[model samples]
Target: MKPGALTPQDAMARAVAFFEHLEPAHLAALDLIYAPDARFKDPFNEVQGLRAIGAVFEHMFATLDAPHFVVTGRVLQGSTCFLTWDFCFQMRRFKRGQQQVVRGASQLVFDEAGRIALHRDYWDAAEELYEKLPLLGGLMRWLKRRARS
Candidate 1:
């Protein structure tokens, strides 16, 4: 079914399905949710088009052991839908023996066609990511604890 034909709830459902189907080895589902010229931005990446967006996901999957997107909530207004997502993944830094789980949220905007036109993520990079990395994680946690005390 075409994205535009689906209701807001259906559209959100489709997006969820896309995420669920996304695997570390393949990325064909992105073509279903993001417009061909969609603009996606985050702490590490700022780019347009599905190819670039797919690359971001590819990189994450490559670096992380198991990466996935969990949609927590969604709001629709007119032709736009704001989606709250929790991106979860496990990454190993510098040949570490184990992987670490990293999570973040994103606010997504969809076009009338139900394709993601813009995706702006909202999360603390220092706390969620930088603080999870090997060396930086130690420094960040130290500073955080020091500030709190």
Candidate 2:
């Protein structure tokens, strides 16, 4: 290991900090944490490259109000780190006054330069998101009940 090279633990910490303190203005600093051609995937989005990834966040900010992440746990092995977090926000349209929480986990793979090369988030949209909506909530709950029986 080089003396001045960034360590995996360091990179993990940076990623966590970036998320916890993230704001609309911080979007420009994503390059500091992610590789140029990094890939990002979640339930609704699958995108490669920093620009596309940033676009996802931009849309998030535009649609949600006061969105933020709270990391509850983390596990680091080699250059890969897994983080469990709660995404909190208020919907701009439905349930505009109520705060929503979506618990999820993300697997991040860091490059040699200590930048995230890949980020994949895992979460159930039906349970976390769809079930909270006005019209969709009823259908989502019904489906869950039927599946459980």
Which one wins on lDDT? 2
User: TM-score of predicted model 2?
Assistant: 0.97
In model 2, where do residues sit more than 4 Å from their true spots? 1-4
Q: Write the per-residue lDDT of candidate 2 for residues 47-120, one digit (tens) a residue.
A: 99999999999999999999999999999999999999999999998777899999999999999889999999
Tens digits of per-residue lDDT, candidate 1, 1-149, equal: 35336666666677767765688555776767887898989888999998899998888777776677777777767656666667765565563555444455555666666777888777778987788677888999999999999
- Candidate number achieving the greatest TM-score relative to the actual structure: 2
**Root-mean-square deviation of each candidate, in angstroms?**
3.0, 1.0
C-alpha positional error of residue 74 in candidate 1 after TM-score superposition, expressed in Å? 2.8
Enumerate residue pairs that collide in model 1: none
